[model samples]
Target: MRVPMILALVTVLAGCADSHRWSPQQNGSARITTSDRIFITTPADGEYGDNVYSGSGRNTAKIIYNAASAKSHLVRIGGLAENYQDAINQAQGAEQDILIFPTILHWEDRATEWSMISDKVEIKVEVIQVQTGAVISSGIIKGSSGLATLGGDHPQDLLPQPIAEFVSSLF
Candidate 1:
């Protein structure tokens, strides 16, 4: 009876640790002060797999944009760019001081409730100094839903907290 109870407990708790997680919080200096000229670009696209790149750029970009928008009183978001150099040019042409580049590295949408597969998302943020064309600060925020997710939950649901937390670190 005790062995059966232990097995049940283990099964119930399995994969709980796989819930959303991020690493290496925002580092470096040069915070976005209220008076700095800042610009941002939507990432290109996120790769799903098997030569199928999901056009989740704008959607993912907005997730981060809205999360960081608590400081939106002084920000300008540019349209999607082809690559890093193009984004830099856009920022410089606009005469901006800083450029925020958000690239979606990986995105996987899985049905966790029935399939037990967790959805995944990885975003990389680069804060650039336009004048010098140098990255003043950067961070990568990755998240994944738990293997035991309830129905109707996506990986994106796990983004806001860490995103908001990271944004708050900037100020």
Candidate 2:
């Protein structure tokens, strides 16, 4: 009996330390901020101070966003899914020497002021050169949005919007 009780106590203590088990707190509105890095590597023979090569090295890019259990509805999945997917699709279709991979997702719960009803989320992205594995350009983007059930307006909506803005700005 003593051994069983001790095991139970230890299990409970370990579970409490798990961050994923914690729920997101509400302050006022939910917000998500995302950042991405875009890099374009020069061709290998382009002249690395000593050598001259043909073609480009390997153009690469990546995008990382804060990780969290987000409700599909809150992200405008049903309503604005087309728009969101279209943007990424177009980027993939663009003419570039490198290949494009799906955006990697990362999320974590954020603490908010009790008086406020909103929470914060963050997203980031990275682009890398395939051949040389070098990062040419990188950037960070962030947005804040509303909480669950109440998904009408969210500050994080700016996340995707900035993606387009940033990509264009890169050129």
Candidate 3:
């Protein structure tokens, strides 16, 4: 009985430490160049909030801004907007040629096994034209952290790599 119990425990622990995989999807075509002026718009209220696993949309926006700014020259970061239209208006007012809007689709923080927890998030990014409000390009970025039991102490750190990967796919 002791041998069986130990084997079961080890199996559970191994399952919890399993590797994670991510798949990002893209749609439409938005041409991004080093010289283009860009604006990052925040999501509306209730779109993304401080839940158990999910951070605020503002946090996601900041991550996206940092990633975009690293590649583009002219980039503006704005506060939370009422809706997508409001974001476009803000971008237009800023005299930006393009707008990068991010929406948090899903967030999960759960224990895969006993005490091992994992953090996952899905962010959809839309690139639109400020003048016509036409969607030039869009993509969904999905990412997960390695198994740990820290209770998401540093969720912000998990986002940069996925955001950078998605941005690289733009051009």
Specify the highest-TM-score model's number.
1
Worst 10 residues of 3 by lDDT: 15-24
Candidate 1, residue 68: the lDDT equals 57
lDDT of 3 by residue, 66-142 (tens): 88888886887787766788888889888988889887676655553344556666767788878877777776666
Expressed as tens digits, the lDDT of each residue in 1-171 for candidate 1 is 999999988977785545554575446666767677768788877777664455577776677678656776667778898888999999998998878888877778887888887888888888888898766778788888777776676556767787777767666
Candidate 3 wrong stretches, greater than 4 Å: 1-26, 44-55, 109-115, 149-153
> How does each model score on lDDT?
0.75, 0.29, 0.69
lDDT, model 3: 0.69
Ranking by TM-score: 1, 3, 2
TM-score for all predictions?
0.80, 0.31, 0.71
Candidate 2, RMSD to the unseen true structure = 18.8
| Residue 93 displacement (Å), model 2 | 17
Best by lDDT: 1
Ranking by lDDT: 1, 3, 2
Off by over 4 Å in 1: 1-18, 51-55
Model 2: lowest-lDDT 10 consecutive positions? 72-81
For residues 11-105, what per-residue lDDT tens digits would candidate 2 score against the true structure? 65653321111121211221222222221222111132343322211111211111111211111111111232343343334432221222212
